[model samples]
Target: MKAKNDAPLRSRQLIGYFVFSILLNGFGNGLTVAMNLGSALWTASAVNLAHALHLTLLTVLLAEGVAVVLFNALVLRRLEWRRIAGNFIFMIPFSFLVSWFAQLIGMTPLVALPLMWRVVLDLFGIVCTGVAVSIYQRLNVMLHPNDDLMQILRFHFLHGNAALAQPLSFVPPITLILICVLATRQAYALNIGTLFSLVAQGAIVGLADRVVFPQLKHRHLVV
Candidate 1:
């Protein structure tokens, strides 16, 4: 029965997973941001930068994306245009979705909810992020530049240990966040949720890989 699925079907499944990731990732980020509990480290860095620099979230995100893409070239020790384009392509819809979801969800009354429920939402957001990341990272049809950087570090430097690569990959963004915090004299998103993401996102993705869309194997070639 499983063999009934063919190449085109698999292609569609990948596409479907890609779209689902974009939505889930966007919604998850929105929830985290609106909760003001915390966000994934990279995202928290972007959000803090945006607030400090008085720029839009999309602007900071794109700038960070480009920087990561270039840094990826440095890691690979060469340039790859297709991979760069794929990163940008994923950013477009993803950025818009995140902004929209944030605005929509932020306007709701959940902010007045109890601390317990807010914590639940924050954790759920983090899990959503981990799961979405698992989907696209496995699909490997394309990836967020930051995730690509993790892949580069994981396979190329860290001996394929995603657990180590995950936090290790945070060095750059974490540095940026530190600078932003000092310059701005405040931090917006660095709480339990961010801590969870920093430590456990890789594990969550690993878990999701064996569970969510279990049939989807990692297409771990170049792009």
Candidate 2:
């Protein structure tokens, strides 16, 4: 009789885990798609300096994403602050190389759009990414290596005060935005779009970490 009761509880736990995992992944996929699309659009639109900046951003983001995946899969295995910082430092050159390539490709400015529209899009993307991270963390699953690093920084350096960490977290994205703004007078038109795209991408990646790749060890246990 005790065994029978335990069986149902185990089944329920399994079902709950699976459901959360699916939700996390689904949200991640959506964010990824949105951010990639936004980046592509910005890259294809910006001219000369603006274009160069866009490409640089893309290259850096891609390098960071790849590095995070590898670090998580191989080196860190579990969250470690030094390992995360090392990963970031290692990827810096890749970011520079990508920027150089963008220059070689000869970037051009994008067609002008309303300033408000740009701002709206950018804000949307940023908000989405933040929300995604929150959701995934709440799921209590493993995070992508890059995110793990960010979380580590937030916890250790900022003493787990999200409010304090939040501003610091925006440093990279904000720097990129500033670069874009300074590169072209017309960049004002793209502020919103750029912000939204980045945030949305973050959110999506967070979701993926939770839902798509949820607690693989637990699943293995069940099997």
Candidate 3:
């Protein structure tokens, strides 16, 4: 049997990995965003999109979720309202949590830390993001729009190669960021952390799949 089927992994199923992933993802992303040292590429893209459009992060995130859902349906050539509903379910509360966490952290002194320390914090946030993504993606139960897109590509298109699918799923954000830069002549949250995120997020998610939570595996999800 795969390690995913082991007794230990089964034990982990009782710990609510979904809930854990939500908090971890929210906190990691919020910290990086609030600090603005850099954040994951997609998050930065969303931030830039928000700035470009003069919208709240939550609004942009939710709107992006809807857009991706349609894109996903296009790719699959079918509209699965149940899957779309789940995407909304994931983004609505999760977006609120992300905003809340960023607001909370912005109020604290952590955002004003020295350059080197802030870099470290931002990098750590990236790592947390990778781990959080790994857990939830492997669980393959509930997922955000971008993540759902990743899963769609990984399984249906890429034949389960996450490293390939992960980066490919970033097209929307990359496009948005480009649009924002063209209009504003600058990008928000594009920095060292974002660079690292562009290169490392997929690999980190791949690594975390095996090391961070070896028991959890992609459950062969279908949308």
Candidate 4:
């Protein structure tokens, strides 16, 4: 009789674990957008090209999400060579698509402005999202599917190298740059906005890591 009661309690505990993970991941994603909202809005207001930048960011995010889903279903499930290859391959086109859409959107009169400004905006967005994901993962909460896959791959290929963690940590931003370049043919240029955005995103990510995640950790510990 006690065993039967304990079984439900254990199941409930597992369910709670899943719920906490989803909530933490979702909150991290939401905070990332909030952190970058200023740059996005400023770009839209100050530059004619901001709208395209906005659309481009949205598209790339969507593409990344799709890639994550497809990889999980087709590759991760099978745990085959194709999964790793497909994941990396899809990322390249996804990057290109992001830049292409940003350019295409920038061409519209509504937000058509300088190409350089749009590039800065895109870079800022990428850096913020990457930082946010990293901090959120450190909370030891549920992970984004992509993050989980990367960790798994890291274990297999790198033999659990601790340094591999940081490399995987930086992969998102690197991929973002590749995507930005694929979409935009212009030479990379550094500007005030680019620097500021990177700093701002880093700051926000740091605060979230230092402040918010600790509280979350405590809550789980108490529970």
Cα RMSDs, all models: 4.0, 11.1, 3.2, 11.2
Instruction: Look at candidate 1 and give me any clashing residue pairs.
Output: none
Per-prediction TM-score? 0.92, 0.40, 0.91, 0.39
lDDT of each: 0.84, 0.41, 0.84, 0.41
State the lDDT of candidate 2 residue by residue for 109-198, as single tens digits. Answer: 211335454344334434444544554343333443444445545544654454444444445445555565566654422433444444
> Where does model 1 exceed 4 Å of error?
1-9
Question: Candidate 3, residues 75-189: lDDT per residue as tens digits?
Answer: 9898878778888889899889888888999999998889999999999999998899889888766688888888788878886777888888888788888889999998789
Tens-place lDDT digits, model 4, residues 1-223: 0111111224565455445444433333332232332332112221222232545444545455455645555533555344445455444443344345445544554244365554444455544444444443443233444654544444445553433443443355445554554555432322443344444543444455456534332111110
How far in Å is the alpha carbon of 106 misplaced in model 2?
24
| Model 3 CA deviation exceeding 4 Å by range | 1-15
Per-candidate count of clashing residue pairs (backbone under 3 Å) = 0, 23, 0, 6
Clashes of 1: 0
Off by over 4 Å in 4: 1-9, 37-60, 69-143, 169-173, 181-223
Candidate 1 lDDT over residue span 101-145, tens digit each: 878888998867899999889889989988998788777767889
lDDT of 3 at 131: 91
